[model samples]
Target: MNTSRRTFLKQSSFALAGVSLLSNRLFAAAAASNEITGIQLYSVRDDMKKDPSGTLKQLADMGYKYVEHANYVNGKFYGYAPVDFKKLLDDLGLKMYSGHTVMNKQDWDEAKNDFTDKWKQTVADAAIVGQQYVISPWLDESMRNNMSDFKRYMDVFNKCGELCKKSGMKFGYHNHNFEFSTKLDGVRLYDLILKNTDPDLVAQQLDMGNMYEAGGIAMDVVKQYPGRFELMHVKDEIKSKNPGEMGGGYESTVLGKGVIPVKEVIDYGRNKGGTTQFIIEQESYQDKTPLECAKEDLRIMKGWGY
Candidate 1:
């Protein structure tokens, strides 16, 4: 083992003696609280298209206890009826803790009456599948590239958060690289959105790897806005040693092989804020098959001794 890996293991053994390791496929006895290690389904989207049900079962077998969904185009969740999907998930011993489906203001305006209707239906589906969060993952073109856009965007966010609150679900935002690079009114657009939105009304699904890629420090964001980030994406970025500008126009690497400060960020998120889950997302694979890449990631996390 490398020196860092050995050091990490030694420390974990000394300090986190009873904590279950996330590396191995074995279940930690201390997971009495039902804590989860989830995967963003987007990682295996192609495989899912080929065989959604079978792929889900395979993911469970591969040690992913939970999943965050990506493809719920219409009222239906994952192309199947919600009830049916729920049963399938239950049979697989998996829980859909969150989803990345977006709803825009125009969508709500044209179907304003349908707003509550659609919202109710989505929340009902979440309940059916045991999902706790429904996240808006992107900013439309109109909401980007300028200052005025962010101001308007915050209003929409607050409104959506209120709607989600009333429906017994949490509303969250999942960011991409643009939110970091794009400036709004001399300040970062992300800062404006977080400041303007009600903390209780809106939460953040802080993609730690992407946040680092966006030129924002993950620990700093969490420190500045405590409790707002209930969920976190735990991926690593392989830094380009050449020292060009990092983030925004950035590239991703396999988990645990990036320049991103993985341990410090997770430690900060877990101890400093309300971090609910540390999700693993692998987007880069230059040398291996998808399954090989995922298995390597699992092995790396296991090596971390957590």
Candidate 2:
């Protein structure tokens, strides 16, 4: 989004466009593996920025076998090249199953009828890091405010799914509070997303806690869209002391310590919503260290039989 980054991507477009795609069969085998419980690295953003290797080692030591990344910049994950980062995780006994990278309009080249080189490199890097899914965590406001544009972007989302499919990966969208609160033509934006995208290609990763502030109930949503969500952001929310942290008077807390029916909802997500990956993510620690919160969340999830 920045000027420098844009220029860099343009300069590297040709080289990255040629990156090879992985085999669909290999990706299918990976997808067929047992369910996973992972942590989103963004929960410890400061620590990762300071010492990615040390932070990862600590997570592995805490019984975390899998992780989902929230940081990727200029074709690198946490400052490490994709292959090198994969090796680091391999050595630490961890696997990165998914990651967040916002795929905005800039990533698409309408003139070429294809993705820009930068996005292609992003997918290439994700494959190199052995990820099953490449998720975009945010939707730009321009795409949301207009009905015609929103529908067009939804089409683009499906096209992205097609691109990811060729590389043995699935393109996924992660939701936030806006999707639940914002509506167009009397239809909720979230519903439009679910309706527009093809299920086989575009997987959904629902953030359970995010929708609460916007009056969206996790239980109802899962029941409404049975067998739609393939992944879930396992989080709990409590009334925030400081309001408006996430455009609502709520912030994430450690699992089982907040108002969310953590157990019941995830149970439904697994049994009825088709969720296979339960990823722990707590954004606010309430005086506890981020790592401490991370440890407790994992313990709680395991106790619940995840």
Candidate 3:
């Protein structure tokens, strides 16, 4: 193992020894506590790609009971078919409750006035795996550039919600910097999305870190939308080594390790922001391995009473 990985294992060794005892109680409390916390698998994307089963075992060892996925292709998650993937997680004492899949305008055929069969399959597979949310994490530039097209696509978001609801799931959208920075008819794209979509049908998975680069504040957003957000991407933003990446000039780091007031915002989400799921994500590991970042993030969140 690399130095960072070795350091992480050494630091967590004592905690890991007691994980089997604390984990069940912690996970049970999280389930009954109205705020379900998890780690987004993207934080350990490379490890997962290399060994999904092993990666999950590591996460379970770190005391994480829930996970959110960033990979799903060809009706499979991390190279396993839905059934097999679910079994893998079950065997490792982990559960994937949410996943990110980008839905674009092309997924909906305007001529047929319906979603493509491929998108439908995505929701179906998600339901089979027991996911509660099927989240679309991006919007196409073409759809956002024009007011009419944008409004039309918002309707599609609602439709997707309806489709997901049939499987006992909700369709959700995750924001990036562009939603706040970009505008349609002089109205911020994020505002337009909230105003147009049905709150009951479609949910928003707010990414606390991405909004920072767009000059949006997490406290301000939760206060404005109140109860519209059902899930949140728990993240913290720090100066990027390579600024100008994706026009955000910032990258995600471990929660509470950056400038964002993560605990305060999450407190609001739990008490009043209508957020039920908080999934931790860290994309820039700095000097640590992704698993190390994930473990630290979880530790900090538990300290904050999540």
Query: Highest lDDT: which candidate?
Result: 2
Each candidate: how many clashes? 7, 0, 0
- How do the residues 1-306 of candidate 3 rate in per-residue lDDT, one tens digit apiece? 457977888879978868965885775556447668899999999999999899999999989999999999888999999999999988988888899999977899889999999999999999988899999989988998899988988999999999999999999999988898988788999999999999988999999988898898988999999989889999998888688435667888878778999999988887667788999988888899999998899999889887
Candidate lDDT values, in order: 0.72, 0.91, 0.89
What are the per-residue Cα lDDT tens digits for candidate 1 across 94-209?
A: 88888888766554553453355666576667667777777888878687667666666677777777777766777788877677877766788788778887878877888877
What is the TM-score of each predicted model, taking all chains together?
Answer: 0.79, 0.89, 0.88
- lDDT by residue for model 2 over 114-189, one digit each (tens)? 8998899999899999999999999889999989999999988999999999899999999999999999999999
Off by over 4 Å in 3: 1-32
The stretch of ten residues in a row with the least summed lDDT in candidate 2 is: 19-28
* Pairs that clash in candidate 3: none
Model 1 residue pairs with clashes: 21-306, 22-306, 213-247, 237-258, 237-259, 238-258, 239-259
Model 2: residue 260 alpha-carbon error in angstroms: 0.9
Q: How many residue pairs of model 1 clash at the backbone?
A: 7
